[model samples]
Target chain A: MNPLSVVVRTICDIFTWFIGIFGIYIIIHGHMTPGGGFQGGAVVATMMAFLLVSHGGKKTLSFAKPGLYTAMETIGLLVFIGAGLFGITTTFFFNFLAGQGGVFGATVPIGPNSGVLNSAGTISIMNMAVGLEVIGGLSLIILYMFKGIRLFDNAAESGETGHDR
Target chain B: MKKRVLFMIAILVVAGTFWGALDNIHPFGDVPVAPMDDYYIENAQQERSVNNVVTAVVFDYRGFDTLGEAAVLFTAVCSVLALFRKGREGQ
Candidate 1:
């Protein structure tokens, strides 16, 4: 699990934070922008992959836990479901909060205009939820693949060849 | 040779289908005449108070589909974890 070359690690260290911030902005402003939860989440996950690839498996694994990612994924799904259930008085996934004049409930004009952050009822919540879920899912996938590669490398080093075990 | 011919025929069929589909598809930068699209565009701002009609459609109007998508992603994560759990434990 040797660290990557000095240049790559340095660049990753410098740029990962900005990448993460951009992704969060995309997710949070999804209701008013073109990019939504999934796209932004993928961007953040890509940043994670970049860091993992640059830092090596052992260090990356030590920095983050698979359990934490699984928990995040679960929480995201639960939040999404809960938000949907909050609208169940009218329908399964009603926009109960829209036009109610509160947090994430401001009404917008009928035509094109500047977007408001505190608008769009459940959409914003769902965006954040989906973003979290996607980030967790994609990062976990990359981590698992890296772990498998590391395991196979170890097995080979130990001279334990073949698929018997 | 038989396999090669079959492969060529398959490629030809797929290409022809794509070509036909592309021919029928709306031209670039042209909006399709969909009442649902018009309805969403006209009503999303008033109904959902969101500027992005796409988000309104996805997270509000068609939330069940999003739930299904989330379920699919969760299933994938579960499968990946199940496959790699033993290796992780061994370490």
Candidate 2:
């Protein structure tokens, strides 16, 4: 696909980092806020789509490696499963770190108040894991779909020339 | 004429079902009594140490479902990759 106009590309360059930052904020604050991993990851994945539209498939694909995303997807799933497994002595998916007074283990007041980022234990860990998984999954889907389109275009061109030969 | 009549009937069935369902709907902002929801609201923060009860429920209490959901997404990504894989050249 061809790149968009210079104006659109310029705007995309200015705003793409903001989109990524916002998505990471949502993922990081999932346990304390409205949005969580799935939602935030989906928001972050839009960066891939946005780049593909503004910069074109060739540049986007070259810049973003499939291997990196594949690794991210695998690692996220492993971490999520590992988090669940760690609490198996009590019960699967237990909040073992909550109230334990450490990273992601701070206790919040029993009633309504401002949220604590250091709270939420395995929930926060799982949120980050799922967020990573979603970012990799959705971006891979978009990239592969674009590649498929290019393959189809090549096949059509080859078929057209075959008729002349 | 027959196809149009069938389409009209189908639309009426869907609309009637929706209209009937609306009558049973509770008033806005008035939630039905649910012991499970009450338990989560009351205890999630204390147990999970998370201010967001919804997140606590999703990522903690009902985490098995989220695991399944993640697996589903992984499978979908795998399938897309397999389908779009480049064919061997000079084969």
Candidate 3:
């Protein structure tokens, strides 16, 4: 079993929620504000990292395998490109799905000016697509770093030697 | 403890939400019927071959960049193939 206490786990959970929510906010209001897809996605991924660090693979990573991040990033990139290809027929970059307000104006319409789910334009769709890819890709990178550290720690515990004079 | 951190983040999010709501430029707008930029018109006229300004800029104005990117990807793939081939041959 892991050695961390309840206090650490609780603290980590709180931080994770904050960072994740904040990052999403930035991504949504990218055009009107300074933050955008890439920035916000990175912020969101950091939440997962926090979870992994404090709670170990059991709590934060039990839902996934080590290669899950890699698969997510690959699929996310493909999805992003698929969205970009829509520009060919529409208006050179006209977001076919950016109907009005949020991610799902049609699916989750807000009655008048679309809803929060409706994406605004091609850029917004592109923003979201890129955001997912960015989050997946960078999250994997962080995971790799920590995994490497864990490997080194295991080696130290085993009293493995590393000498090359 | 974790509660404090969560509270801090919650505070940040609430503050940010208020900030976003208060300083929104286009709080409400209809479907865009026209181009949002004038550069598209100018570029379309300057480069008349393609009808789509976005395509023209991507494929024409920055064709060289695309070519270089393609070349880099090709080279990386070739190197990876070579590395794998050598290991297989040794066995």
Candidate number with greatest TM-score: 2
Scored against the native two-chain complex, candidate 3 gets a DockQ of 0.03
lDDT of 2 at A155: 49
Ranking by lDDT: 2, 1, 3
Q: Which consecutive 10 residues in model 1 chain B have the weakest lDDT in total?
A: B82-91
Q: Each candidate: RMSD to true structure?
A: 5.1, 4.9, 16.6
TM-score to true structure, per model: 0.83, 0.85, 0.50
Candidate 1 residues lying further than 4 Å off, grouped into runs, are: A150-165, B1-32, B87-91
In terms of lDDT, model 2 sits at 0.90
**By DockQ, who's the top model here?**
2
Against the reference, the lDDT scores of all candidates come to 0.86, 0.90, 0.53
Q: What is the lDDT of residue A4 in candidate 2?
A: 76
The 10-residue segment with the lowest total lDDT in model 1 chain A: A156-165
- lDDT (10s digit) by residue, model 3, range A38-142: 678889888767776666644454564546655655565555556556656844343455334344322322222223323344444444655666666667655
User: What is the clash count of model 1?
Assistant: 0
Candidate 2 TM-score versus the reference: 0.85
- What is the C-alpha DockQ of each candidate? 0.73, 0.76, 0.03
Instruction: Sort candidate 1 into its docking category.
Output: medium
